[model samples]
Target: MVSSSSDPLATRHSTVSRENVREEDALKVLSAYLADDMRACNQAIIDRMQSSVPLIPQLGAHLVAAGGKRLRPLLTLASARLCGYQPSAEQQRHVGLAACVEFIHTATLLHDDVVDESTLRRGMASANALFGNKSSVLVGDFLFARSFQLMTADGSLKVMAILSEASATIAEGEVLQMSTQNDLSTPIERYLEVIHGKTAALFAAACRVGAVVAEQSEKEELALEAYGTNLGMAFQLVDDALDYAADQQVLGKTIGDDLREGKITLPVLAAYDAGTEEERVFWKRVIEDNEQTDADLPRALDIIARTDAIKTTLKRAERYAHKAAEALEVFPDSELKALLVKTVLYTVNRVN
Candidate 1:
């Protein structure tokens, strides 16, 4: 057994990795580590998103140009490399598979903005905002169809099953969230289930497929799956917290954006549960009743601060991040393994 004492992944995870951990640093390191494989994935994504319909590629290019981290596809590529997948350049299908993950993720983003009536994505005008909702929704469907084609080309029944299930689960999660929207009474458990379906299911599937291609043991596959799930949970929880607490300049998103959308995040739930009766009334007005005013944001922030809602939400995120790190214990420590562990820590601690 590799002793955890000497392993940097385990050691830093137990100590400094949890402090001053920047998301950008992890992105840079991971980008460097997977440089070659990532190029292939990028090229594949570019090639596959092309459509004879000018509007399809035009809109797809806009989204691809907007450029978030591409974290899901990176997870797929990294997981495969960690599992010793070293196919010859000609045999490299990890690129196609990773591209497929990105397509699904991109499709969901397009669909989500429409559902949320969002105007901005990554600090720029959203696809729907620029292209119109009808165009955005149709292009999103186009991306989904493209993703399925990528999956079929791979010709792996197991991979098809995993990605398809994740796609369906994402749709179901969005529906579940709609039912709970603007209801301060939404159970924390139900909220968790929603994130698991909408966000983490794809993360889990993305990681698992990498292992599947490498023909790793079931034990190893599950470990990576667990890692992805918990990382995703932590990622989403931190995102919720950030919407209330993060620096606007760094993340290119404004505080209180999610609250304005009637998102019932952990901080909102905590404040609702811990607040005085009068505070409850305020929450109902702004969030539940959807009667928010310009002054309401400052008031909401004050209430959340008083109740330690942001802090509490972040603490909850920490628990999930720790679990994600622990899930990697089955893999012997390598640079990739250590970076993966660090990525888990970054998920929870990120300011942006």
Candidate 2:
């Protein structure tokens, strides 16, 4: 349930348990378990990212070296293992396919940085910031082409279809977000649709392809897809909330960037709905009118504090996290399963 406290900051001090494993620790454990496969995948990524064009390789290396957690590709590897995929010829296919997933993810990030006009990514200069928007966009297209090559090399039409659809869906989601940007009238349902397409579609495809490559049962594939989709939702929700709540240093990006971009995220919607008439004017002036001033972010935060927006947004995230865990219940207990469940908790606890 969302907190009822009128004190907007009350949730920050609420005594939620800190017993859940940290995100980094859980990732470390997963990485250790999949060390060999990850090594192969990393090598594959390096080999594939190379280009005769110096600028292409240089720009790709810059972003790839920026050191994201590789969580999406990790999900591909871990889900395959969770489905009892053993190391062998078929398992080598998983490594290559996992590399493909990473390529797709990296391509999206390149394009996203351009679209968001973001200066920083993964705590470093964004590709567009360093290489220029034209280079970033073209390199992103190259990555997409490389991803398709890997998919075709896998020789599974089903896998190709799933990933291709996800790619298209991600673009659609970006367009949807653009249409909704600065529009406070955007409903929560539409916002969710945008996230499912932009964020969760790739995640769902990543896990589902793992099952497909492993030749797991349909039920198991569906379960992994559910886990991935819900986990992605939770991940994006926490990210949205963190734009308002997180420390700029820890967040790796400027706080209030969403507001500056006139993006109406869930917390903003909640606060707008719950705000008084006078407060609504402030929101309209800043968000709808795009007239945010230097002092507006703090006052916007103050308005959010008076509402249950942050807590409610987090509550929704927790619900999705719980569903993600539940989706894995069909799989037998193991260290992998346990770690995946812990990952859900860690995702939600990022702002805690």
TM-score between candidate 1 and the true structure: 0.93
Minimum summed lDDT over a 10-residue window in model 1 is located at: 1-10
lDDT of 2 by residue, 1-352 (tens): 1113332222243212354223435666677788988888889898999989898888877876887888888899999889988767644778888999999999989999999998878679888988899998999999999999999998999899989999999999999999999999999999999999889999999998989888999999999999999999988988898888877776576788899999979999999999999999999999999997899999988888789788888999988988999999999999899888877776777775
TM-score of 2: 0.93
Q: Looking at candidate 1, what is the lDDT of residue 251?
A: 67
lDDT of 2 at 311: 86
In the range 69-148, model 1's lDDT, one tens digit per residue, is: 88999999999999999877576867889999999999999999998888778888899989999988998898999999
Q: How large is the C-alpha RMSD of every model relative to the true structure?
A: 4.6, 5.0
For each of the candidates, give the backbone clash count: 0, 0
> Whole-model Cα lDDT per candidate?
0.85, 0.86
